[model samples]
Structure formats: C-alpha cells, structure tokens
Target: MASEKTDKSRLRRDLLRTRAALPEGDVPVNGHALARHALQLPELTGAHTVAAYVSVGREPSTREVLEGLRERGVRVLLPVLLPDDDLDWAAYEGRDHLVPAGRGLLEPDGPRLGPEAVLAADAVLLPGLAVDRRGLRLGRGGGSYDRVLERLTRAGSRAALVVLLYDGEVLAQVPAEPHDRAVHAVVTPSGTTRFPAL
Candidate 1:
C-alpha cells in the first residue's frame, strides 16, 4: 500500500512537470480539438446539462469545449470552490461570467447552487493528471473530485462521468485506492476512449 502511494506521488510529480513545460498557445488548437472530439461522444451528445470546470495552466483547456457546448444550447454548470475544497455549482453564462478565484482558478460569478446541483447534470467532466487503461484517474492530490464522485454515487446519479486529457496522459496503469471510482470515458485531443465497454 505504501509503495503504491509513493509510486503515485512520483508519477504525479513527473506528469505535472511535463504539463508545466507545455507552451502557452492559449492552447487554442488542442482546446478546439478536444471540444470537437467531445461532440462525438454519445454520452455528451445525449446530455443536456453538463457539470464541468474551466481549465487553467496547460491542463487540456476546456475553453473551446465550454464555448461549443454553450453554443449548442447545453446548460453548462461550472464549479465554485468551497472553503473545504468541495465544489458548489453555478450556471455558466459565458466567458465574461468567469472571474478570478482562489487557487488561481476561475469560477462562475453567478448564484451559488448547492453541491447537489450536479445531480441534474446529464454528464460531468473531470480534471486529472493521468488515467490508466482501466479508467482509474490520478488527480492533483486533492480529494475534491473524490468527494464529488462520492456524492454522485450516494445520490445514484446516472450522469456520465468523463475526463479530458492530452494524448500522452493516458497510461498503462495508475495507482488506485479502493475508494476510487472509475471514469466512464476519456476525451483527448486525438479522440475518445471508453471504459467497461459502453
């Protein structure tokens, strides 16, 4: 168990370093490609409300994906970080509605809807450093998304859970704890990969 934790720590450090080295192109090209790939997902195509987050740093930018979803009339819900690191949600009106928030994050400036607001979403997009072929995700050492997934499970949510990653971020394996949940699919700039077979 300890060895797995150490391995996860090592992998996270290595992956984050690689991400930091990426060029700041506003990630326009990759962002738009990620958005385009997302459109091909049956889960996304069927979803009306999608719980998502804004990308900061070199993390696969959700900029184009968010804008595209909004343009297509999808009800976009963005997260607001709480003091405890759990997320509260709000409606995404547009880029102008996002304002600087703590942790160098941009959050929705709209009314605060409780955390359960994600329950109404037909899909949920998650952030990750990497994902294993089995769909286990390596997050940024924060348990926020873990809590969100727990809440979704307790609520029996049918919302499709997804992760947007860069091509190389998909790996053969990643550390996983018993409490960890597997994501349903991963959308990369190249294309989409599903887990547990649809």
Candidate 2:
C-alpha cells in the first residue's frame, strides 16, 4: 500500500516537472491541438452539458475546448474551488466571465450552482497528471475530483469521464488506490485514446 503511494508521488513529481519544462511557445499550439481533438469526441459533440475546468500553470489548456463547446450550444460548467477542496460549479459565461481566484486559478464569475450541478452533465472533463493504459487516472492528490467522482457514482451518473493531456502523459502503468476511478478516454494534443474496459 505504501509503495503504491510512493510510486504515485514520484510519478506526479516527474510528470509535473516535465510539464513545467514545456516550451512556452509550444503551449498554445498544444492547446489548439488538444481542443481540436477533444471537440471531436462524440461524447462532447452530443452532450447538452459538460463539466470541465480551467487549466492553470503548465497544464494542457482548456480555453479553446470550453469556447468550442459553448459555440456548439453546449452548456459548460466550470469548477469553483470551495474552502474544503471540494468543487462548486458555475456556468461558463465566456472568457470574460472568468475571474482570478485563489491558487492562481480562473473561475467563472457566475452564480454558484452547488456541487451537485455536475450530475446534469452528459460528460465531465477531468484534469489529471497522467492516466495509465488501463485508464486509471493519477490526479493532483487534492481529492476534489475524487469527491466529484464519488458523487457521480452514488448518483449512478452515466456521464462520460474524460481527461485532457499532452501526447506523452499516457503511460503503460500508474499506481492506483482502490478508490481511484478509471476514465473512459483521454484526449491528447496528438489524438484520443479510448479504454474499452471502462
């Protein structure tokens, strides 16, 4: 058990470091590609609502995806960090509606819609450090999305779980805990990979 935790920690550190070292000029290019590939996901194309997050730091950008979904008439929900590290959601009004928030995050300035709002989404776009070949996602260890996934499970949500990443973030294996949930697919800058078992 302890070894798995250590392995996750080590992998998180390494992956984050690699992401931090990405060339500044390449970030937007990757973001554009990521958005293009992600928008093509059948789940998002047919979704009436999608629960997603705004990317920060060196993480793969989600700006274009959010905008594209909105342009497609899909309602977009962006996460608002609560004091307890659980996420509260708000409608994504537009790029101008994002307000600077704590942890250097950008959150929607719209009215709070409670955490349960994600239940209405047809799909959910998760932010993760990496995902293994079998679909186990390695989150940032904050446990916020864990709570979201738990809520989804308790409610028997059929919302498709998806992750956005750079081309190399997919791996053969990543340490996982029993509580970890597997994502259905991952959309990278290069293309999308679907896990059939999930």
Candidate 3:
C-alpha cells in the first residue's frame, strides 16, 4: 500500500513536469481539439446535465468544452471547493461568471448547490493527471473527487464517469488502491477511449 502511494506520487510529479514543459501555443490548440472531440461523446450528447470543472494553469483546458456544452443546451455544473476539501457545485453561467478561488482555481460565482447536486448529472467529467488502460484514474491526491465517487456509489448513481486529458496522459497502467474506481471513458485531444462499464 505504501509503495503504491509512493509510485503514484512519483508518477504525478513526472506528469506535471511534462505538462509544464508543453509549448505555450499547444494548450489552446489541444483545448480546441478536446472540445471538438469531447462534444461528440455519446455520454455528453445524451446528457441533460454534466458535472465538470474549469481547468487551471497547465491543466488541459476545459473552457471551450464547457461553453460548447452550454450552447448545446446541456446544464453544466462546476465545482466549488469547500473548507473540508469536498466539492460543492454551481451552475456554469459562462466564463464571465467565474471568479478567482483558492488554489489557483476559477469557480462559478453563483449560488452553491451543495455536493449532492452531482447526483443529478447524467455524466460526470473528472479531472485527472492520468488514466490507465484498465480505466483507473490518477487524480491530484487531494481526495476531493474520491469523495465524489464514493458519494456517487453510495447513491447508486448511473452517471457515466469520464476524464479529459491530453493525448499522452493515457497510459498502459497506473498505480491504484482498492478504493479507486475505473472511469467509463477518457476523452483526449486526439480521440476518445471507452471502457466497458464497471
């Protein structure tokens, strides 16, 4: 267990370093491609509501994807970090409605809908550093989304779990703990990879 945690932390550091080295122009280009590709996913196309997040810093941009989803009439929910590191959600009005928040994040400046609001989503877009061939996701080690997944399971949510990443973020394998859950699909700038339902 300890070795798994150490391996995960090491992999995260390496991934983040690589992300930091991306050319300045590639971020938006990848974002545009990601938006185009992600919009076509059956999960988002068929979804009435999507729980997603706004990318920050060197993370793969989600701005274009969020706007595209809203234009298609899908209700978007963005996360707001709570004091305890759990997420509370709010409607994604537009880029104009986002305000600077803690940890260099931009959060929706609207009314908080509480964390349970994610249960209403037909698809949940997770933010991750990497996802493996087995579909296990390696998150930022904050445990926020872990809580979200646990809540979803406890409520028996059928919401499709998805992750957005750059092309290289998809790997053959990543360290996983027992509590980790496999995602349904991963949409990268290049294309989408779907996993059989868990």
Candidate 3 error regions (>4 Å): none
Writing each residue's lDDT as its tens digit, candidate 2 over 1-198 gives 899999999999999999989998888899999999999999999999999999988999998999999999999999999999999999999999999999999999999999999999999999999999999999999999999999999999999999999989999999988899899999999999999645
Model 1, 115-171: lDDT tens digits are 999999999999999988999899998889999999999998888989999999999
Candidate 2 regions with alpha-carbon error over 4 angstroms: none
Cα TM-score of candidate 3: 0.99
Q: Please list the residue runs of candidate 1 whose C-alpha ends up more than 4 Å from where it truly belongs after superposition.
A: none
The C-alpha lDDT values of all candidates are 0.90, 0.95, 0.96
lDDT of 1: 0.90
Model 3 has an lDDT value of: 0.96
- lDDT for 54 in candidate 3 is 97
Q: How high is each candidate's TM-score?
A: 0.96, 0.98, 0.99
Residue pairs in candidate 3 whose N, alpha carbon or C atoms collide under 3 angstroms: none
Clashes of each: 0, 0, 0
User: RMSD, each candidate, Å?
Assistant: 1.4, 0.8, 0.7
